[model samples]
Target chain A: MRTSKTTRATKAFEKALATRPTGRCVLRLYVAGATDRSRQALLRVRKLCETELNGEYELEVIDVYQQPILARNGQIIATPTLVREYPRPMRRFIGNLSRTAGLIVGLDLETKGKGAV
Target chain B: MKNNGPQSATPTARLPKCPTGIRGLDEITSGGLPRGRPTLVCGGAGCGKTLFAVEFLVRGAVQFGEPGVFMSFEETDAELKSNVASLGFDLAGLVRRNKIVLDHVHIERSEIQETGEYDLEGLFVRLNHAIDSIGARRVVLDTLEALFAGLPNEAILRAELRRLFRWLKDKGVTAVITAERGREQLTRHGLEEYVSDCVIVLDHRVNDQIATRHLRVVKYRGALHGTNEFPFLIGEEGLSVLPITSLGLNHKVSNARISTGIPRLDAMLGGRGFFRGSSILLTGTPGTGKTSVAAYFAQAAARRGDRVLFFSFEESPNQIIRNMRSIGLRLEPLVQRGCLRFHAARPTLCGLEMHLATMFREIAAFQPAVVIVDPITSLLAAGADFETKGMVTRLIDFLKGGQVTSLFTSLTQSGHALQQSEIAMSSLMDSWLLLQDFDGNGERNRVLYVLKARGMAHSNQVREFLISNRGIDLVDAYIGPSGVLTGASRVAQAAREKAETLTSQQEAARRKRELERKRATLEQQIAGMRSEYKTEEAELRRTDEQVGTRTRVLTAERTELARLRQADAIRAASRTPGKPKPKSKR
Candidate 1:
């Protein structure tokens, strides 16, 4: 089931890479330390941006253990939190990137109905 | 007992405390909250939970010299600073001095999405950073329950909270975690399950339409704390938990005496007055001069240069001043001199606890040597009977603790048993003066007598409490066939007795004069009788002399005839017999 879901996500990412970017996406990933979850979240977010947005995004990774002021400024309470600072209304995604569907919907990368993305 | 050893008896076995420096709170907690452990502070809305948390941090930083970190999930940095500024806590100054660090952690659920399991590692890192920056020894997470609302998963949030509390403990920072009070639980999100070292519950209850805030230590692991709910107040200074009953009867007693302003009343009270640092209960019916007696006491104390704080629940300060002026008591000068202060408020202005808190605040601020509560019974209108009694007990205890002489005037109902009704508080008083109205001669007059004066040989005689324009004068009430005659009846009784004495004196004088006149008339009659007897006796003497002369002549003639006849022998014998008879007569 996990493999099939990944394949489906990859196919959507390929379809999104075929179109030009409509708007720039500003993302900030806040993590506590160099933990397994932080690494997984960073990799997942980087891969998603590279594939879905096709380099139409600016991603900043912040380690709360080192740069806690940024985390505090961003109102980060949960570890491995993904904050979308641009594309108009701001949104945050909490937890590791084990589930990509919620993140897609939060980042406005959902290609279900709206065609603006 | 767990057989902890001899140290347990020496206080070394008890939990080390981190003093919050809040007034009366340290007394209730037996020092303060458990040191270096997470304490859960739960309360309902507007119950001063945030203030408690803020005060804990501010006091920890400013007073105890231990830096603190305040991570508020609800209010921002500026908001928290301004909110606590009214309490006189300079949060900004503390932050600038590196004694405190204010970090606001806001989480809006509407702008967030949760996909999977996550921990509160970000919060821990932020707290760690803030604490490390200032080397803070105390941490406060005010209203940490906001996380439950912000996060989507409760199980994970609860797990993370457990870990966070443990982490706080490992960090060796005394942490205060405030949460919302829940129905049938200590906290809304069951935060008490974690942070179980100590749990404090703040309650704001409205009794008889008056709101009062109370604090109770619900749970304290391995530490002793006051379990009873203590009334607390959020005043200009800060939160003060009143552990009034805990004051006990251990206050120092003073042998010094203060006058009651009325000379005769002082004479009645053992030729001096009430003892310094003693609680005096003055109970009377309405219009029976209770307030007058209290005012006199206040004036007396003020005259002696002792500050007097008058708590008038029945009348305003101006009204009291005006009324007292009618009795020739000039309190305006004492008030102006700052020796006498009047705090007047209606009984229904607040709850008994609030009233008590206000009184405590006033007493603390004024630092008066004498306190007068005019008509303390008015406070009963704002609370239950037992509650009022408790409040009075606490007030007396507090006053006694400060060595402040207190006089409490209680207004009793006209027909209720005075002593019986006052029995609730009478035991707590060191001296009790009962002012009553004697109804006779178609008028009611005030009478005062000391019902009980502990450790003093007080007068037992009832005194007529006269409130004239000259002031209170305690005159000896007329005690006669009518009990305790006062007012016009006493004067009338005195006048009647005087008139009776005068009439009896006049009757005695008139009878003596009549007796003297009768004796003089009798003496004159006796003198006249004596003169008549003297004249009769003189006439009898003259007749006897004439008879003797006639007898002498007859004898001479008989002797001449006998000699001529020459009968010498028989005549001589007769003459001898006559001579013997004459000699016998002589």
Candidate 2:
């Protein structure tokens, strides 16, 4: 399930105190309509999440059409809006979920600049 | 005095209300389509019927933060979402947040069996559910005509639409109902005849082979709205209606003057310049240097660190800059410095109202000290004559209220020699410059003249000008015997005069030489006469000498012999002979 930014951030802080895990993250994709573009984005994001954050992450997909209340809750304006809910300091990206490198950087997944992944 | 006796009773004063968010649409309606009442949006096919209703909902939600609901009779939720995506409105997001609800009411005309009695209660229930679920303050019905296709009974369909509009009012939601325009009636099935609060008609017409979309507010009870048809635009930015009406006489005015950047031209306009916030019309035929003059004004304003918004209807920013370069107007640097903004678009792309709204939005965003519309006449082609005039007047009034200096260029027919006749906005303009091409001596010359300037003295004389690589330059007008020679005629006349003067000087020198020769001949003859007289005297002297010599020779021998013999005899008797001869003579 997609959690609010503040709640997810608070949970991350609590987890940091409870257990010093090596790496963990939570990602959510907020899309307006389920067009071919949004479908492609969902598929690509799912694959990336499974491969990258295999055991220590949660991925949730929210379609604004089916769930418009969530869109306003997120203050989303454009379609395929992705919000990085976890890891203290929330961030969001608007557009198709392409550009893996940019997404990784945006999510703070890589530890170092070049070889962290 | 008697009217003040019953002052004790006072009615509750009604507070001024905000419009139902359509941008400039609110200002035209004075406040907006009466609050919480049904305002019908009717148009023909593909004339933005659905989009207009949707935009009213979207703008209300996003701009005003008011919750809205959209009831579509034709399209599904998915179709509406994607269609509005290009306009940057995420309708689905509004839906997800419960701020907006999109009800896709499916109606199959072939399947529905119309009994003796038919009502829109099903649609009303769905509408009420959507509106209450979101607490929507605004609602839109895509097209009421769609129900006619299903229900054959015209009387029932019309009655049902009337009931639906009344229901919306009772629910206290400001609703916009879209309907198809009919060929025989203002609305399909004469729906406009039944609607009470307000009726707006959307039209898409082709005139002179150009397609133009227009919106007219037919009736708005208890509210004042522009009664003229307004041109509208639908694009990535959504639907913008241009309300062509003045904002009335409450605008602020300033006496400050701003330069148009052409020094001589500015000098012509009251030695200072035009009023700071006034609207100036630069009208002329093609190639009369309208764009150059506007660019020069924009660049000048930018140089003073004041922001300038330049709207070009004909040329792109690059083309305008490149062309201005010929006249020494460098706008790229100013644009780079963020002092100047260049917006270029085709006038036919949007309706007059949309263009004006876009202009107002840009002005609000940029907050420029000056705004320039390269050619305002291009917009006139999009509407009827009266409509065009109203739109321009309203635009000028709005600009004046905001204290933004507006410059507009208009293209007139060549050789007409008349002021801008398409729209009667000349009197409304604070300053007017007339540019024309005068055909004289078989050559066309571009000339600029100030027609009128209110509250300022301007040059009335027409000045000759040239559009060269360096920019526009005011050349002194050539006054010839026939009339004024401008452009090529003046240049040719100057050359011809030089040639004539040289030939005349040569001819006069030839005459002088002939006179000098005749005088010399007369002088020589007089000198010859003196010589001849001397010769005659010399001959006379020589003849006299010869005569004297002959006489002396002839008389010398006889006279000497007689005198010698007489002297010898008379010598002795001379003493005695003198006394005897004297006595004898006595």
Candidate 3:
């Protein structure tokens, strides 16, 4: 039931991904507390920003318990919510963003649409 | 008899309940929204979604003494404060008192671009911050559906919304999330799916140019709730949902009596008036002085030191007060004394359920012993007949349960009395006062009759209702030949009777005078005769005495000669009557 497809939606996504400049990245990472998942989420988001933006990036790591207002403003439901706030269309990923391939696909960093991207 | 959607009353025993404290809302939901679980409130624009959310928080903070956090995504804190100001909720003051926390989450579609990946973690954090700051037990996310518009991420938004509900449940804070109704679904963004505890649909529709608002609980995961589309209103008191519940017949019966304000009407109602806590329906046509009668009742209740709440659908408070003055009912003093309260609104101003809800709210607040709804038929113009009946049934139940006397007036079309028998609530009414306008003899006459009075014997005779400067009066209707007479005819009938009485009285006086004259004549004649008889008797006595003296002198002279004659006469008499000559007789 979930595998139904619309090619227009796919084309739209690829177009949005290709049009992005990706020069200066803005990231807000939300973590719950001083736990393993929090530390892992923070470390992974920081590493991705460093490598991807090449030092031209602003990263905001928010501890949900300490600054819950910011997290709530971001509509954060789960801790370790990485929000890429720059570009034309904002995208969100759950978990710590530890899987680089999954995170890459979610962020549209490397478009894999053959007919479009 | 209309089917009001599907009725699903699944017992939700597992989920703890959160009472919203809004009038009639808790009753419909059985206990309230599922406790600590997110309940989705989806509605069209301007259908009281925001007000309902705000009221939930405010009521939580004020009534339940539970601190709440109102996280609005569309309106700012200032806007919200001003919006709810009419409801008497001081949002800022509540915030200062640490009873509530207001957080505005504005989402703009043009503010962001997609770089890598993002989540609505900020919203969660802010809501958490507000909750923690006040130790809130209730949370409201006002229109989180803005995210569906501000951000082009339906997949992620839907995913995050589910997580939010789960998180709210985990935090043990009851949350209310409002969303706009979708074109084909309850919520535009499918927020109903995420909030499994409850999904309430608020509908605002304009049928025949009359706008009405309705609310329905489409699904409650674990609770029993009314399935009908209840009409809700956002007024000075806030959101009140009118639950169209049946009268369970569990009202506490009272034997006390209260007056109908009109002495004669009271007389018609078994002397003292209606039974205490009884529902009285005063039905009449236009301009039959229904309001005046109701005002009289309010005056009576107020005069008796009982608080009275008068709801005038046809007239404003000032208008009623002024109009009642013509009938000598001065309600302004009672209002000033806080014994009489007036709630006036147009029948078209709100739906039937909304009217019921507003009445319930006012009744709860004023705590009046008597509630008078002048022209309750006006509420029929707002909704279908069945809906109004359901609302009225619930209202009667509520008033009866509280042992509060309630009076409802309805306007019919004509004097036929049976023309607008549309309500058919005579069974529920403890007493029904039917007023009629007798249009005959080139005049309109008002008449009142006790159509029905349950639990008491009431007069079956229709009386001509007389409205004077003093107050309302009911004169016994003349049932002579004509069906019923009133106004000029009644007065003329009374005058005619008075004239006949006067003529009869005059004739009686003349007969008495004639008899007295005859008796005086007879007495004079008798007196004259008595005088004559007395004179004759005196004359006879004098003559007899003179004769006796003459006879005695003659007898002595003739004694010697009579001796010889007397002896012969005695011997002849003895021979003739020998048997009579016995010893004693001799």
- Model 3: runs farther than 4 Å from truth? A1-117, B1-14, B61-139, B150-164, B243-247, B261-263, B313-366, B378-384, B439-445, B468-473, B481-586
Q: What is the iRMSD in Å for candidate 2?
A: 19.2
Model 1, position B504: C-alpha lDDT score:
96
Over A1-117, each residue of candidate 1 has an lDDT whose tens digit, in order, gives 999999999999999778745678889999888989898889988998987787989999998888988877888899899888887578988888888877887776777314533
Q: Using lDDT, give the best candidate's number.
A: 1
RMSD of 2: 19.1
- State every prediction's TM-score relative to the real structure: 0.85, 0.61, 0.71
DockQ of each: 0.58, 0.01, 0.13
Could you tell which candidate, 1 or 2, scores higher by TM-score? Answer: 1
**Deviation in angstroms for B427 in model 2?**
2.3
Q: What's candidate 3's i-RMS value?
A: 5.9
For model 2, residues B301-357, the per-residue Cα lDDT tens digits are 899888999988989999988888867788899999999998888988766666777
- The candidate that achieves the highest DockQ relative to the unseen native structure: 1
TM-score of model 1 vs. true structure: 0.85
lDDT of 1 by residue, B1-586 (tens): 5676675676745679999988888888888988999999999999999999999999999789999999988999999999899889999999999999999988899998986657888898889999999999999998888998899898898888889988999999999999999998888878898877899999998876778898999998887788888888887789988854465669889999999999998999899999999999999888989888899999989999999999998789999999999999999999999999999998887788778889988998999999998888788778778767778888888888899999999888887637454897899899999888888678998889899999899998999988899998988888887576789988988999999999999999989888888887787788777878887888888888888887877765566456556567636655655654664466
TM-score, B chain alone, candidates in order: 0.86, 0.71, 0.76
Count of steric clashes across candidates, in order:
0, 13, 37
* Tens digit per residue, CA lDDT, model 3, B122-209: 5677777788888999999888887777766577777778888889989999989999999988888777778877988888887767
